[model samples]
Target: MNDHPHQSSSLTAQAGLPSELNQHNRRADDSAWIEVVQHMDSIYADLVHYQVELEEKNSALEDAQLFIQSVISSISDILIVCNINGEIQQVNHALEEIIGKTAEELLDKPISSLFCEQHLSLIAEFPEHIRSGSLIDCQIELISSEQKEIPMAINCCARFDHENRLSGMVVTGRPLGELRKAYSALHQAHEKLKTANLQLIQSEKMASLGRLVAGVAHELNNPISFLYANMHALKNYQQKFKTYIDAVHVNTSHDELQKLRSQLRIDAMMDDINPLVEGSVEGAERVSEIVQNLRKFTTPQEQKKQSFNLILVIKRAISWVLKAAKTSPEVIHNYPAELNIISNEGYVHQILINLIQNAIDAMDHRGQSKLVITVNKNDDSVQLHIHDNGPGIKQQNLVKIFDPFFTTRTVGSGTGLGLYISYGLATEQCQGDLTVSNHKDGGAEFILSLPLEAGK
Candidate 1:
C-alpha cells in the first residue's frame, strides 16, 4: 500500500474487518453492475422508439408538400407564394404562362418584380392591410417577356406557418380582359331575351287594341249608314213642311179659322216629319263613314304585296281614329294628298292607324286635339312625319322608348311594345327606317321613311 500512489477506501480498510466483511463488499459491487446494465438497456429502447417517430414525422411533411404542389398545378389562375421578406418562394404553371418566365427564372426574385413602376404603389399601399389578416381584391398590370401588358384581378391573403405567425403571402390572379368580354356577352344575351319577351306581350296587346278600334268603328257605321240612306226622304219631308208653312202664313189673318182647323194634327205633322227625315240622313252618313273606316283599318289579311293606292289607306286610317274618338272629342288631321307607295297595304294601314290613334289618345278627354300626318316623296322613298301636341318623351329615354316593355305611361294605359313593333315592321316588312325625337313644339315627332317603290 505504501508503494501505490493512492488507495481506494475499501482497499485501505484497517486490518480490523474479518473475511465475512470482505465478502459483503464484493456483493455490493455485483449489485451496482446489475443496476447499471438494466438502466442502459431501458435507455437504448427509448432512443430507438424516438428515432422511429422522427422518421414518421419527416415522411408526413414530405407528403404534405407534394399534395400542395399538386393542387397548385391543377389551377389555371396564377398561384404565387412569397416569403415574409418579399422573395417569391413558389409559383405555379399559370404564373409562367402569365409572366412569360419559367419557374427557375422567377424563384428567389422579389415579389414586386411581377408589377411595373406604375402599379408597384398599389402593393406597398395594401400589403400592410393584407398582413393584418384582411383579404383584398385589387387590379395589377403585369408586363410579359415580349413587353405585352396584361390586366389581372389579384386577390391576396396572408399565409402563416405552423406557429401561427405570418410567414408568407398567397396571391390568386385572374385575367380581366377575358372576364370582361365574357360579362359583356352575357349582358347582351340577357337584353336580347328581355326584348323578345316584351315583343310577345306587345303583340297580344295590339291584337286587343285592333279589336277595340274595330268595335268602335263598327258602332259609328250604323247611325251614319242610316242617315245617308234617308237623305232623299229628308228632302221630300222638307218640301211638304214648306207647303204647310205657306198654308199657315196665308191663314195668319184668320186666327178663328186657324183654331177651327185641325190645329193639333197640322202642328204635329210639321214638327216630327222634318226632324226625323233630316236627322236620320245626316246620322246615317256619319255612321256609314265610321264603319267603312273601321273595316279598312282592321283588315285581317295575309300579306300579299301588290300595287295598292297609298293615299286611300292613309285616309281610311285617319277616319278610323277620328270615328273611334267621336264620343270624347274630334281629332283633326293635316293628312297629305295621294301618297302612293307600295307596301303590305294592311300592315301599312295598321302602322298609320297606330300612329294617328296614339296621337288622339295623347289628347284624351281634351277639348280639342290635332294630329298631323305629312308625307313627302323622295327620289326612292316616301317620308311620313307624324306629329302630336302632347307630352314628349325625354331625351334620355328617347332611345329606350323603342325597347320593348319600356313605357313612360302607366300600366294598362300603354304597352311599351308599340314603338318597338312599329320599328320592327318598318324595317323588316317595309324595308324602311322609323325614328322618334322630341319636336320643338313640345310633342314627340315620329318620322317614318318608307321606300317609294315596292320591295319585290
Candidate 2:
C-alpha cells in the first residue's frame, strides 16, 4: 500500500503482488468507478427532461383556459347557467345588465321570481326539458329591478354530469321586446282593418235607407191620390146636401128637394161620415205600412240572421230609389211567385237598393230613362237582373267599378264606395255573386245570384 504515490491506493495492488492480480485489481476498480459515474449522468438527464416537459404542459393548459374565458365574455347575448332545481348558478354581465341585478343577488334565488305571472307556468316547464336533456326555445318576459318588463327568447339546453344525471342548464337569451312591439303593431293594424270594414257596411246601409225612403214616399202617392179624390167627392156631396137644406128652408121643402133627399138617403149624409171614416182609415194604414218598411231598412238587423220575405225587400228597395231620384226612370220588375230568401233582410235590401240606384244614376246623363229588373228562381238559387238603358261602362273602367273610392260621377255627388260595399256583402256575406256587364240588348245589367234556402 506504501509503495504507490498514495500508499492506500497502491497497497491493495501490492498485496496481490502477481501481474494478473494487479491488472485485475485496476480493472475492477476502474469498472466500479465508471458504473457509479454513468448512473449519476443518467439521473441528471432524467431530471432535465422532466422539468422541460412539465413547463410545456403547464403553458398549454393556461392557453386553453384563456381561450375558454375569451369565448365566454365575447358573445353578445346573455348567457346563464342554472341547476336542475331552477337556481341560477352563473350568469354573464349582459344578463345582469338586463335584469338590473348583480350575480350575487341572483344566486340561490329561484329563477322563476324574475318572471311575471304569465311566464311563471312557462318557467316551471323548463325543468321538464332539463330532465329530458332537451332544448327549449321559448319567448319569456323577465321582470327587471326597475319594474320594467323585458321580453326574451330563452334558448335552453340540458347539461348532464358524468353519471348522465341532470346537473344544470345552459341558456342563451335573445331580446324579444322589439319583436313583441312589432307583433302588437300588426295586431292594431288588423283591428283597424276590421273597423274600416264595418264602417263601409254602415255607410252602404245608410245610402240604401235614403233610397228606400224615397221609394216609400212614391208608393204612398197612389193611396194618397185616391184618398184626396174621395174627399173631393165628399165635399161635392156636402155642397149638394147644403143646397137641398137651403131649398127646404126657403120653400118649406119643395116637393122635388124633399123627393130627392128621400131617394138618395140624404138624411144619412151627416158630413159624409161613412166615406170619410173608410178613406181616412185606409190612408192611415197605407202610411203606417210605408213607415214600417223604412224603419226596417234602416235598422241594424244585419247583426242577426233572420228569415223574411225576399219580395218585400225588393219592393222596399224599388220604392226608395224611385222616391229619391224623383225622375221618369221607368223601372219595370218582372217576377214570378213570392220569394222568401232567408238571410239578413237588411243587407238584402241594401244590395238591391245599391244596384237599382246605381242603374238610375247611370241613366241620369241620358234623355230617355229606362230600367228593367227580373227576379227568377232555380231549384236552389235566385237570380236578380237589373238592367238600365244607359251608357254602358267603358272597357277601361269595368275592372275598377268595385274599387273603393273610385267613382265616375262628379266630386261630392258620389262617394264611390257603393259598389265596393255591395259587392262585398253580396259575395262575402250573402254567399252570392254580383256582376255588371253590357247586355246584348244594349243596356248594362247587374246580376246578383243568391241561394234560396241555405246561405253562406
List the global CA lDDT of all models.
0.72, 0.77
lDDT of 1 by residue, 4-67 (tens): 2223325735665777877776666666667778999999999999999999999999999999
The all-Cα superposition gives candidate 2 an RMSD in Å to the true structure of 16.3
TM-score of each: 0.40, 0.38
- Runs in model 2 with CA error above 4 Å? 1-73, 77-353, 367-370, 394-406, 415-433, 438-443, 452-456
Worst-scoring 10-residue span by lDDT in model 1: 1-10
Worst 10 residues of 2 by lDDT: 1-10
What's the lDDT for residue 225 in model 2? 56
Task: List clash counts for every candidate, in order.
Answer: 16, 6
- Give stretches of model 1 more than 4 Å off: 1-17, 131-135, 195-456
lDDT (Cα, tens digit) per residue for candidate 2, span 1-456: 223334544886667688777777677667667777999999999999999999999999999988976887677788888888888887777888888999899887787887777888878888896677667998888889998888888898888789988788888887896567889999999999999999999998897765555445545654465566667768877787787778777776477887878766786776467856675665566667557755765673544567788887787677656645647687787985478877767667768877887888889878888898899899888899999999888889889999866789898767676788788778877888999998887878899998886444
Task: Kindly state the number of residue pairs that clash in model 1.
Answer: 16
